[model samples]
Target: MSANKKKNLNSMEEDPTADDSDSSSEDDDDDEPHPDAYTGNEEVEIDFEGRAPTDPDCHGISQLLQRVFLRAPINTMQMADMIIAQNYVGSVICQCEPDGAESDMDDDMVEEGTIFGITTVINMTAKKDIACIEQLRGYIIQRAEKNAPDSVLTHLRDVLGNEGRPVGFLINERFINIPAQISVPLLENLHKEVLTAKQKGMQFNFSYFIMIVKFYRKEARKGKPAEDTYTNAEEEVICSKAVNSFEYSVADECDVGMSGDWLEGDATLTPYRKIILLDAKDLPHLIDDIRNYISGV
Candidate 1:
């Protein structure tokens, strides 16, 4: 990773809660109602005996309330006025889209690394916390789509099966920082685990990953010296600037490998978005001396 890329990661990964705390507090305070104001808890009689016809468009609570409010001694407008007189607000609540349905679907699509209608799972062992892993998965997908459009995401799936279970590595919240330390193992272990499976007659679409996540320092000046010095004290995990998808697997380099045959030019140093592609050599070195290499990056 370049210095600028690391800076960008820092900005993205910076702890959101740490910045300009007073300004955020003020924004929260602005949304609150006056302390002296009180919302009424008094309940109105439904007046079922004086029920009125329901509107065709009305549904659920609205339909039930229509029977009472439309014909009751007090109409809807009158009820609204009463609430306003008490310094309270009212809104006609309506059903919205099913909660979290769209978000869940998007998360699934990302976690599966679905691209060009193909789905690949990265690590089989990393599925303990479905929600957290899904979140990280979604983040990776969005970043890849935005940054690594032309790059091919090296797709790999467990040969055992791809149903009713997680197929990718467990991604934790801590991946935002110390990327090389935490993430390199994920890719390394993934290759080893799946290769072992392949030796046992397990088949997969693709294999191996040369992935590294690195973070760097950034500084800015705000005119005043005191305000000018800004460091990423709150580490934030941001999208990788360099993402390269390859068709090569490190396992293929092994002569005795059962699944893949060695092929030259299989690995392409393609840039993801404008970010430079990671070198094939970088993968092994980072795995071997991740702390030292990340520090130098």
Candidate 2:
């Protein structure tokens, strides 16, 4: 992890900043939120009235809400207004619905590496409590460490999984590797725990992930030709609801989301949005475009 890049995935910091590369763990002790930040108690708290969303397979909450809002026969401004009134921030809510329903499918991605996706953003609230933000951060850290025989992870996944609340994670690609047998017991443990959290009116998070995959090359046939190529022979257990449809076992390389942080923001004058259902890497450049548009440059 470059000490300089202090955003999600690479960010171990509670706050994201331009000069965060030099920051040490001790630096987060301050009570200050960032200059462009707005923090608040963010939740969707859907009663569901014994009904899931029209499309429940979609794993991202922000994505789910956006779709529901858009499909409700309301204008953009009206839908935006509803989102703000609900105190909604970015979150990935995992839900498994009965078959044949409108799908709320956010993208499902898997990769092999120590690096993965996680993000940090500033909240915009006048009455926002910084302590709440700090407390939230502490809670997340504690969540990750609750599991014992903790994998290569220095932190436990529980502290990070906090009810599917979109949290952030810091991944040092250099921090992950496997020499002995790779038994994904931790991921299996996480899948079960996520269901329990939802039963009690909570959401499971999908922000930070630590992905490590091992691969081997073999021979195979494609239609008429036979070829021996690389394949993944290991079975990776994942939280089914955390993501959409996925294969139970693959042999080439195994990638699973690791631990991380969720972002909460405020929108009083303008509408606030986080967890846009779009991948962070995709949106960053667009955000740059928006900034340029805002400046009339």
Candidate 3:
């Protein structure tokens, strides 16, 4: 390659899809301004540090990867290593690369005049975890940048040690499946824990609240006293009533489970309650209305 060719290659590698627009808007490029400076309409990049294992990092990049890992046919561990090696952390952009045969060049762009494979630009860091994030970030940025420069861009600080699902729980608490009959008390306990975490400025990722109830009838015992037999109709009636009443106070049930009662004992009911899983966007509202949630929000 001639000296000019070598210089051009280096430049293309530096920024294969660099925009050279002369727009005066700071949002057009990678410049930070005062929080209030930019209008909300303009494209901007923001970073967030979430508190829950499921809370998406920044632009849901990590969460997207997690979903991909779960469904991907390839080895997750190897993919993680590849991502890290490519320094694919932070905001990633995915966009088309142009071919060299095309002589037409957008003079305003700093990109190479040639087309290539899709470009993924990383922040380029020594830390494997950080690099992984940057690689993703670059991939996302490129995709978004393919359109107008103002289309999309996002980023997040590194947290994962290795690529897998983020490993953190709300206040580091484990979730348990219990009967809905005790949801009130359990919710109250969660309210307390959440309130304390909020006071200390902590973050967590459990955001859903759920409840399920099953009813059964008691069968007559030959050796033992007859357990009261609650009929299936009676069980259904009770479960339906409970669900209807709970919806008024708590979130509407996204799903519900029901089962016939086991023979023996007075008709019996078991309610499985799961707190609604929340997203990062919903955390503040949850923290503020935790009392309402406990009481019947």
Clash count per candidate: 7, 40, 56
Q: Taking the tens digit of each residue's C-alpha lDDT, what string does model 3 give over 1-297?
A: 111111111111111112343213333233211122222333322211111111122222322233222221323243334333432111122112334663343322323221111111121222335544444334323433443233112212222222332322121110011112222222333444445544765432222211122222233456764332222122232333221211111112111111111121112322222111123334344433533433464
The model with the greater lDDT, 1 or 2, is 1
lDDT of 2 at 222: 60
Error of 2 at 2 (Å): 29
Candidate 1: lDDT over CA atoms? 0.25
Candidate 2 segments exceeding 4 Å error: 1-184, 205-216, 219-233, 236-297
lDDT of 1 by residue, 247-280 (tens): 2112222222111111111232111111123332
The global C-alpha lDDT for each of the candidates, from Candidate 1 onward, is 0.25, 0.23, 0.25
TM-score of each: 0.24, 0.18, 0.19
Ranking by TM-score: 1, 3, 2
Against the hidden true structure, what lDDT does model 3 obtain?
A: 0.25
Name the runs in model 3 displaced over 4 angstroms: 1-65, 68-129, 146-286, 289-296
Deviation from truth (RMSD, Å), model 2: 24.0
